[model samples]
Target: MNPAMNESSHTPPLVEISGLCKWFGEFSALYDINLQVNSGERVVVCGPSGSGKSTMIRCINQLEEHQAGTIKVDGREVMPGMKQIEEVRRDVGMVFQSFNLFPHLTVVENLTIGPIRNKLVSKTEATERAMHYLERVHIAEQADKYPPQLSGGQQQRVAIARSLCLQPKIMLFDEPTSALDPEMIAGVLDVMIELAEGGMTMICVTHEMGFARRVADRIVFMDFGEIVEVAEPETFFNSPRTERAKLFLSQLLGH
Candidate 1:
């Protein structure tokens, strides 16, 4: 077994963060945050609105720069202005809460843009990969339609398909279902659960405990800009160690 495996016997984390902190002028958004996501792991981070969950995930891909600490992806330390950042970005795909689809483009076009722009594939190949993921997300039939023509759930699914066309090794979902209607949330989550079962490494910042319970290997609890607890889903929900986590679970799970 690799010595770096942290109990599950998997290899070292595909993503690792240590002593990460982010600041905006006088305000601090993150502090002393540390986390790791082993390959094929699904980690769900849940917490209050200001808990820095989104910022932490954003830093993993350099979407948000951290003032202090180190983030390494695939064993290479993330550095600013380095060509390695592009490689890291290519290996990691992110799906935001808002669909972020191009309104002027058809779903197929939207999905092909990243691969085509990066010259990762020829136009024909990108389109083929786009359709494959669209089918996987159950929306291949809508490939010719523009973003506005799709339902909220369908748009979010398209967003997921767009990310998949990149053939990334890891996926980051920042509150992917937050902008959807209650009815739409489940559809998006269902696709995510399928993605998880397929053994894709995923780090999600979402408040949906049910989804966490269903698909997450571990749940990370953050509060006031710091990680408060990290536990397996069953232990996290049933036996949280911190009052902040308990209160958060109660508030979220409370009717």
Candidate 2:
């Protein structure tokens, strides 16, 4: 997986980060980050807690502004106040650890609101679009119910459907299954795997080693505010290049 920064010969990568850095007052959250994700690539990022994995993906979608470095989506730089920022955001869907669904809104309403309000889609069209994705995530039967009426796994699937309603070109998952009960984790991961198989350009920050191994084209390992390793799943799992990666795998895999 040629992740070089310069791929001007063909269509540019879907997402690119060069020398990215982030700081929060006295603490540095990320340092000198560089990575490129091409179209239809599934990149899984894993690391210990407080290791900047979430911060890095959050930076990609502009949920967290970086202090330094360039992040380009479809070759357009992501900045705090860029005129095209909204356009960029519309094309990039983010699913968080928390469901973040509005309790007052029905599942379908939660999904339709974004497209209707932001994209000027008609309510009927939005609802139809919402249901289409709801079915995709295997939660269409829960469409008329409120988020609080569903289980954790169902709620998270609704969140996934909401993101899909926008028909985003890229999807970012931030520890999506972390908040779920152990049994619910597989349902969310199943939906994610299906999404990956459908050729979504995905950047997932997850600790689910099985999902990472099954879906990721490359595994990005981060620690102490820096990316320490990048390798395919087999190589990373069996023979990590760095001591930090080795220790992280051992701890996570219980070896």
Candidate 3:
């Protein structure tokens, strides 16, 4: 019945990280990292190579474990060796730079396997879900083709559809366009932009400033294993608050 207590009872963020730290032998990949992503928020992470941008998001899905930190997804605590880790993973979908599709499987099969095997959905239902997502990505016509048969962009679209099959609450993209040819990048970005417009919560690690400006609600700049600045896209690109960010933007946009 206290006024201050009532005021502080706001909803928690959809994904929350606190005091996150990671080490590879003696090298600290991430240090004292903290971040929170809310429902339907699109966050873009940008930084130079080896700045721990990828490592930080990987920790969110537990692809790589952190030695110390607290990660909570949907208000459930996520820690190393937790039995509920699989549940956490199911809610967090990730697309890597590489397509990572099954070489021998058809596109439809690749999309359905996770739901059929993991969620125990019937084959009919899984295929229906697969086709729906494939259609959403504009690759339904290629659903019967193998990964080897599709162009790089089509293959990446399949990869995105595969993740969507799970109907995850959050999507993590680890440089989704970096592995594609320059001509192939636009297709993938188009699919991503469409997903953003549909209000999917997304955390992307990319150097594509154009995409960031167009899609991101906030831009997170990291350097030397630490977050250098966090700001709105307009502020981050036009008038960054930190010296590191200013220099980074200058070098990145210098051409």
Candidate 4:
């Protein structure tokens, strides 16, 4: 085993990407991307709106197919085949900007579906897991409510719990708090911070510099479909290596 792997045996980065590139029609969405997250590393990706941060992560779970290069999760390559893609997605859970809960299902039901479908756990066992995660996210009381009945932050927390119910090795968040109100943002961030403290591998795309500063082991900055800088959060924030990164940070922190 690698020395790094020996030190952290619990959740060492179950995923890695190298030379990853993605294109839409003629426009490139990602270029020569390289990133490695140790089993439980908390990585925050920040960049301007069109910087491709979302696209890079979307490729990891095969949600957005990459045109070239390799993506490996839990040491398994993510390929074009449906079985491969489904397996990768089963181990990696994603939370979106807009909470993607099922309107027809109750909160508890939404959480139970994935595990039941993928793991074939009995409904009773799945509900047990769903409720566990719901309590973890502080929404156990709302388990019977429908998605439309909850607040945005509550809905997002449910979404997080739903993913956790799958027992994914890594969690991906794409602008999770973007649609939340200021007061509610803290509640969601609190749960995320707790998850990080417990050593959950995470890759999050958000403009919340405060959350990045507190939780990120490293910060990745991308621009024009390419990574411009990857550094410790302090270094990335205090002295960005690239001019593009500097400009982007300036606009974000200036406000």
> TM-score of every model?
0.94, 0.95, 0.95, 0.95
Candidate 4 has which clashing residue pairs, if any? 11-39, 12-39, 13-38, 13-39, 14-74
What is the clash tally of candidate 1?
Answer: 0
What are the per-residue Cα lDDT tens digits for candidate 1 across 126-214? 99999999999999999999999999999999999998999888999999999999999988999999998888889999988889999
Q: What are the per-residue Cα lDDT tens digits for candidate 4 across 36-155?
A: 888868899999998899999999898888888988898888866557577778789999999989999999999999989886599999999999999999999999999999999999
Looking at candidate 3, what is the lDDT of residue 26? 97
Clashes of each: 0, 0, 0, 5
TM-score of candidate 2 to 2 decimals? 0.95
Q: Which one wins by TM-score: 1 or 2?
A: 2
Q: List lDDT for all candidates, in order.
A: 0.90, 0.91, 0.91, 0.90
Which segments of candidate 2 are over 4 A away from where they belong?
1-9
State the weakest 10-residue window (summed lDDT) of model 2.
1-10
Which lDDT value does model 1 have at 7?
55
Q: Assess candidate 1 and give its lDDT.
A: 0.90
Q: How far is candidate 1 from the true structure (C-alpha RMSD, Å)?
A: 2.6
lDDT score for residue 33 of model 2: 98
RMSD of each: 2.6, 3.0, 4.1, 2.5
